[model samples]
Target: MVDGTKKQSLTDNTIGALLMLNASKHGSEIALREKERGIWKETTWAEYAEEVVACAAGLEKIGVKPGKAVLILGDNRARLYGGMLAISMLGAFAMPAYPGATLDELKHFLGEVEIVAAIAEDQEQVDKILELKEAGAKGIDHIIYDEARGLGFYEIDGLMSWDHLIEVGTHDLNEAPGRRDEILHRSKPEDPAIFLHSSGTTGKPKGIVLSQKNVFAAAKNGHDAGAYGEAEEILAYLPMAWVGDYAITVAAALLYRFTVNVPERQETVVRDMREIAPTFYLAAPRSWDQMLTTIQVGMEDSTRLKKWLYHFFMDRAIASETRKLNGKSGGALEPLGRLLGELLVFGPIKDQFGMSRLKNAFTGGEAIGEDTFVFYRALGIKLRQFYGQTEISAISAMQSPNEVRLHTVGKPAPGVEVKIDDSGEILLRSDSVFAGYYNKPEASAEALEDGWLRTGDAGYLEENGQLVVLGRVSEVMYTAGGERYVPNYIENRLKFSPYIKDAAVVGAGLDELTAMVCVDFEAVGHWAEVNGVPYVSYSDLSQRDEVAALLHEAFQRVNKAVTEPLRLQRFVSLPKEFDPDDGEITRTRKLRRKVVQERYADVIAALYDGSKEVHVSAQVTYETGEVGKVERSLPIREV
Candidate 1:
C-alpha cells in the first residue's frame, strides 16, 4: 500500500528514471527502431537521448513553457516518445491525439486544447492544422513536423522539421549549461504530465489528465510483474494513440532500459512481432482473438494426423500450467508426453504466434470469450485480464501469474483498493488514478464521489477478492415480460461461434429477442470457397441463402449455450461490417449501439418484424465523388 505523496519506487525523473539507465548500460545498443519502406531503421540510446534533448531545446526556443499543453499526432515512431519526454523535461504536459481522428474531430480537439506548440507526424497532419487555422481556429501559432516528406508547398516558415530542430538544439546547449537542472527543478511530483482521451464510450471525447505521480504509481504494478526487465525487446505496434501502448513502450519499457521496437504499419505487426520475439507483450482482446482465429484457420487445413498431434500438445500445455497454478509440479505426466507436446504443439505454436519468448502477456479493452481466455492461460502464456479505464491511469486490477481465473478479471493491483458500491459498480481509490477530466470540473465531479472514481461498470468481488466484471450498467435493458438482461452477455454467447464474428441483440419491451449479426468474413469466406459457393462482394455473400442457413445453425448453437428465454428468436446478417471510421465502433473496438442502430435502423426493424426480407434503399457516398443508392432486399430469418 502506497501512503503519503512519496512514490514506492526510488526513481524520481521520467527520463533520468529510465532512459538514462539504458544509455549508460547499453550506450551503443538500439534503444528504439522504426520501420520505414519495410526497412527497420535503428537509433541507439545515446543518439536517442541527444535527439530528445535537442527537441526539448527546440521546443523551448518556440516559446513552449513548462506546464503548457503540447499536442502530438503520429504513428508509432521514435519521435513520438522523444517528443513526449522532451515535453516532460520542460514540465509541460503531452497530449497525443489519435492519428486517425477525423478532420472535424481533429479540428474540434485543436480548438479545445490551449496548445503552446505541437509535433505532427508529417506534412499531412501539419496541412490539416494549417487548414484549420485558415478556417479560423486560434491559439496554434507553432508546429513541428517529424518527417519532412512532401512539405515543399507550404510557405509557413514558422514550422520546423524535427531534424533541423535537433541541429538548433546542439548549438543552444552551450549557451544554457544548467538548462536540464532548471527543467527538472520546475517539475513537481504532482504536476500534470500526460493527457490521453478515452474512446468516448458514453459520449464525446474527454481528456484524462494524469500527473507524473499518477502514471508513475501505475508503472510500479507493471514493473513488479516483470513487464520491464533486461535483455527484453518489446513490439510497440499497437496505436501510439492508445494509453496501453504508451504505458508499455514509452513509460515502462523506456524507464526499465528494455529495447522498444516500432513496426512500420498495422499490416506488418505480425512480421515485426516474430522478428522481435519480445519477452513481454500486451494486447487488447481483439488482437488475441484474431491470433486465435489465425491458429484455428491453420489447423482447419491440416491433415488428420497433424491436427491430432496439435490438440495432444495443447492438452499437455494446459496440464503443465494447471499444475503450476496450483503450486504443484504434480510430477510431470509421462515425461516423454510432455516433451513430445512441447516439440509438436506448445513450442511450435508459441513460436508461430510470436510468443515463444514471452515471459508475460496481458489482454484488456473488452471481455474475451471464456474459451479464448482459457486457451492462452492453458498454454502457459501467463496472459490475464487486467481491468481499468483511462481515468485510473489504465491499471487498477491486474491478474498475477497463475493466480488467474477465467471467469474474473483478477484482484486489485498493488496500490489500488477496490470496492463495490450499492449498485454493484466498481469503485477505485488509488494514487495511480487520474486527478480529473481536463476542463470539465462538473463532469469530473460527477464521475468522482468521496475520493473514489465510480467505474460505471457493474461487477462484484468474489470471496477470494477477485473482481468479476458484469457488463456496463448503462448497457443493461429490460423486457416487456419483466426480465432483465445485459445484451453483451447474450451477444457474447452468439459470437463464440466460428461463423459469427459479432452480434448486436436487442429486445427491450419486444416479444422475443432479435439480432443483427456480422459474419466472420475470413472464416465464412474460406468455408464458402471450400464449399464452392458463389459470391461477388461482402454484401453479396452476406445476403446469400446458404450463408443465412449457416448462421441459423450458429444461432442454434448459441441457443444451446443459453436458456430458452435468452435465446435469439430472429437474426439477420448485417449488410456491412461495423467500423471505427463509420462511428459504429469505438477506436478501442467496443461497439457503439446507438451509432450501429442509427446506421442499420432497417436491419434491426426487419429482425423484430415478421419480414423475411426487407428492401433497403440507402444513399452512399463514393470515393470518386459519386452518390449512389444501394437498393436490395436483405434476407431476414427466424430460427
Candidate 2:
C-alpha cells in the first residue's frame, strides 16, 4: 500500500481535469464507441470533450448548478458518460440510478437527495419519472432524454430531448465560447462528484457520496497497476449504476485514455462481444456461470466424436491449469497436454466466448465456484477474482497474475490497507474511501471509524498477503450444535454443477443443512431431452423423478466432499428461479438471504419434516405485466 502522504498527493486531480488531460494528450484518438444498428460509432477524445462541454452548458440552461444533484438512469451509453461528466463539470453530484430499478426503489432514490434535474436513456425512463411526478414525487424539475422513440407525443412540462438540450447548449456556447471551460476550471477535487446507491442486499439503499479525488485516486491506482493501457478496450456492458462501471469505465478511461465500447442491448451483449473482443473485461459470478452453462449446453448436441475430443482436451487443460493455480510445475504430461489442449480445445472455446484477446479478465461481486474459476483458466483465459465493496470505490484487493490463487482475491490494491478485526470483519483504509452516506451521519460514522472503513465482510489475510473473503458476517450461519459455516461457500459448490442456476443453503439453527436449488432452465431441460424425459414447464420439470435422481447424484457428490458439520443432509429444487423483480435478489444479482428464507419457509419446513413433496401454489409475474399462480408438488430428495 502507498503511504498516506503519497495517497494525499493524488487528492488534487478532479475527474473533469483528468478528462481534459486526456483530451489534450490524445485529442484525435478514439475515446468511446457505441454500437448502433450493428455498426460501431466512434467518438474521438476531442469530440468527447466537446460533447461534455455542450452537455454541461445544456444542464446549466436547465438551472442545474453547483451543489445540485443530477440523476442519470440508463444503460451504458456515450450520452450517460457525457451527462455524468457534465454534472461533475458544473460541480454537481452525478447520481446514476439502475435502469432496472423498481418503482419503489426509484422513489426511494428520488427522495434521498434533492435531484434538480435528470438525464434518462429513453422513453421508458422518462415514463418512470412522469409516473412518479403524477404520483406526487417532487424535486425533479427537468428531465432530458436520449432516445426519442415512443416519446414523440408526450407533451409533459420540463421534458426535453437530449438533442434539443445539446442544441440549447450550442446556442449558449456560440454566445460565450469559454463558459463551459470556466465552470470546469472552478471545480474542486474535494467536491462530491457522484452518488452511487448501494445494492441494498441487507436493507434500503444508501446514497454513497464519492468525491472527485476519491474516484480519480481509485482509477489512477488501477491505471498505475497496469490493469489496462491506452491501447486496451473494454465493453461497458455492466449497469451504469454500479460503482465498478464508474471506476473502470468512466474514471479509468479518462485517466488512461483508453476506448470504452458500449453494447447495443443487454441481450445482444454476448454476440456483440464476439465482434469487439475487448482487451479488458470484468463480470459478476452469474455472468461467468451463464457463459459456462451456454458452452456446456451447446456441447450436448454435438456429434459423438466431437464430444469425445472436447472432453479429452478439456480434462488435460484442467490438469495443466490446476498445477499453475497451485504454484507448481505440473506432472511431465501437463506441459504437452496444455500445449495440445490450447491448440485443440482451449483456443476454440476462448474464441467462441470472445475472450481470445482478453488480457485482464476479472470476476467479482460474489465468490465464483472453484470449478467455474478453473474452467476459464483451464481454457487459457486469465480469469481471476477480486474483493471489494461499494464504499471503497469498488476495489480493495485484486488478483495479480503472477501470484494468483483460486482461493484468494490476491493482494490489496495499490494505496489500500486491509486489516481484519477480531470479529473477522475486513477493514479498509484507502484514499478512495467514500466521503459519507448522504444524509446519514450516524450510519456513516458506524461504517467509517477513524481512518478505516468497515467493509461488513468477514475475511482474513493470508501469510502471503492475499485476501481470502468469506461471506457477509451477518449472512454466515451457525447450526444448533454450534458449527459455523458460510452458506455461499457451500452453495457455490452445489452451483458448480451445470444443472444448478442458483442455490440457497438453509441451516441457521437447524440440526442439518438443506438447500433450495434453482435449476439452469436450459441446461437441465436439455439433459431431460437427451435422457428421453418429457416435461412441459419448469414446475413440471423440477418435479420429475428423473430430475430428482440427477440432483440426488450431484448432491451426494457434494456431500461426500463436505467436511464435518457443514455437510448437506438434503436439498430440494425449486419450481422457479429467483427473480430480482420478485425481491428474492438484488438488482446486482445478489441473493437477499432474509427474503429468500422467508419466501421459502414452507419448503424449509417440508425438508426438515422429511416430507416427500410440498405442494406449492405461488404467485408469479410474467414479462407482460400479468400475474399468475404456479402450482406444483416439488420433490424433496435426501443425499
Candidate 3:
C-alpha cells in the first residue's frame, strides 16, 4: 500500500495512460458492458485498451492531431466510450454533444469548436452532422459512424464505418506500430481532455474545457469521499453529453476501475437497471421524480391489502426519517416500523427501482421535493443530493452519510473550498474546477474571479458547512410590496404533490404570486378514469373543472406550508407541458424562465387580470417537422 503522502499525490497521466495501467493491472477484469439484441456483452480491460489503441490509430490516419477537437455524438455505448478514449490517446480533446440536440443547437456547437473529426453512434446522429454540413457547417473533415444499418446508399464524403476504421488501423499498425505509444506518452494530465458544454439555461450553451487533471481530480475526490472501489458497478444511462455522466462513467470509472454498464436503449433503462443493480447511481431530480412517480402510480394501482401495508409501513419510515431530519435518534416505534417496512414494502420497491444493491444514489441538477427526498431515504435507499456545475467539472459539493439533510446540498467535496460571497452567491475553488470556457473569454472571465468560480447561484453556507442553494441570484425576485421570494423554493413545495409534475411560479413585481402547473399525466389520467372525468388530450384534461379542483387542492397544501406573503393566490394548469423542444425548458429540463415568462405572457396577464379563463393558441411541433396550433381556453382558479 502507498503511504498517505503518495496516496494524495495527483497522477500526471492522461486517461489513455490510466486505461493502459488498468489493462496491465487487471487485464481480465470486465471494464465495460453493453446490452445489444437482448444480450449483455462485456469488454475486458485488455480489450478496452486494444480498442482504444486501434481507434486512436484510425483517428490519427483521419487527420486527428494534438490539441484538435473530435466531436462524439451518441448514446452511452461501447463505441462512443472507445471513441472518446481514442481521441484522448491521440492528444485530441473529445467534445460529446447531445444526440438529441436540434439542428440549430448542433449548428451552434459545431460552429464553436474547430472539430477535426466526428464519431457518431448511428445514422440518426450522422444525419444531423451531414445536414449541418449540407448547410455549410465548417471544420469537420471526417465522419466515423458505428451502426451502419440504414446508410448503405448515402454517398457522404469523408464518412467511414467503425469496423472499417479499426481494420484500417490494423493495417496501419504493421507499418507504424510505435505511433499510438508516442501519442499516449506525450499526453499529460494538464492537457485538454474533454469539452463539455454548459446547460445553456441562461443563454447559448458555452463550451467548458476540462483538462485531464480536472477530470482526474474530480474522480479522485468522489472516490475518496464515497470510498468507491473497483467492485463498484454503475449504469451509464444518462445523456453522454452531460457533465455528470462524464464525471461518473468516463472519469471515475477509468481512474478507479469500476465497471460501467450501458443500457440497450433509453426506453429499456428501467428494465435493464434491475439486471445490473448498479452499486452507485446518479441522476438529475427529474429522473428521480419520474421514478418516484412510477412508484406512486404503481402503489395506487396495487391491491387494497398491499396498498394498506405499503401506506402503514411507508408512514412509519417517513416518521423515522423525519425524526432523523430534526436531529433526533429515533422514536419508540422507529426501529420496528423500519424493520416491517423494509420487509413488507420498501424491499420489493427498492428491488423494482433497481436500488437493491445501490450503496449510494445521488440526485442533483435542481432542487428535489423534500417529500421525494424523505421517501427515498425512508425506503432504506441511500439517496443523497449533490450540487455542482459544468465549470466545476460537474461536482463541488456532495452529501455524506453523516451530513445528509433534506433540501440542503450538503458540504464541499474533499479538497474543495467553498465560500458564500457578500452578494449571497456561492464561490468555489477546487482541484476539479475547469480551466475556462472555450472561445468565450469574456464569459469565462466573468465566471471566474481570482481563482474562485462565481457560481451565480445564490446560497449560504450553514454553520455545519452545508450549502443551501436557493435558485439563481437573478431569479430571486421581489414583490411590488418589496417582499423577497425564491420561486424555485416555492415550486419545489408545489411539486411535492402527486398531482403536480412541474410548475413555474410568477410574482416578482406582483402583490401575490401565481403559478402555472403541468399535471402529472399518468397520475391525473388514472384519477380522471377513476372519477369518470371525460378528457381527450392533455389540453382537454387540463381544462376539466375536476382537474382544476384537484390542482387547487394541491396548491392549497403548498400554500398552507408556506408563509402568507409567499402563498400563491392564483394558479392555472398549463395547457401543455413545458417541453425542451418548445424552448420552454433546457435540454437539462431546467425551466428557461425568461422563455416561459414570455411564451405565457398572456396567461400571466389573465391570472392577474381576474379573468376566469384565458384563450391560448399553443404552437405545437410534431416529430415530422410539422407545426400545428392548438387553441384552448384554460381556467384560472383562486386558491
Highest lDDT model number: 3
- Cα misplacement distance, residue 396 of candidate 1 (Å): 1.4
CA-lDDT, candidates in order: 0.75, 0.83, 0.84
TM-score ranking, best first: 3, 2, 1
Number of the top-ranking candidate, with TM-score as the measure: 3
Clashing pairs in 2: none
Clashes of 1: 1
**Which is the better candidate, 1 or 2, if ranked by lDDT?**
2
Candidate 1 structure quality by residue, lDDT tens digits, 85-170: 88876777788877766656666676556777778988878877787678877656888888888986677857878877777777
Q: Tens-digit lDDT track for model 2 on 1-639?
A: 122333535557776666676677678999988998889999998888878888888899888887688889888878988899889878888999888777788789778878899999998889888877888888789999988999999888889998899999888988987786786576888887778888888889888988888887787667665566666798998988899888888877776666889899898899989888899999987789789878987776788887888999887777777877777777767778778777777788788878889988898887777778888888878787887788888877888766778778888888899999999999999889987788999989989989899988888998888899877888777899999898877777787677777889998898999899888888889788878999999988977888888788768777886776888888888888888778888888778898888878898999999798898766677775566778788777887
| TM-score for each candidate, following the candidate numbering | 0.90, 0.94, 0.95
Ranking by lDDT: 3, 2, 1
Model 3 C-alpha lDDT per residue in residues 1-639, reported as the tens digit of each score: 012333435545577677777787779999999999899999999998888888888888888887688988888788998899788777777988887778788788777867888899998888888888888888788999988899889887899999989988877876887876765566778877788888777788888888888888887777777735555799988888888888889888887788989999998999999999999989877677788878987898899999999898898788878778888888676678777778889999989878899887898887777788888888898789888888888888889876688868988888789998888999999878886888788988999999999988999989988889988887889999999888988887787776787899999888999999998887789889878999989888987888888888888888887888988999888777877777888888777889888988999999999899898887777776577887888888888
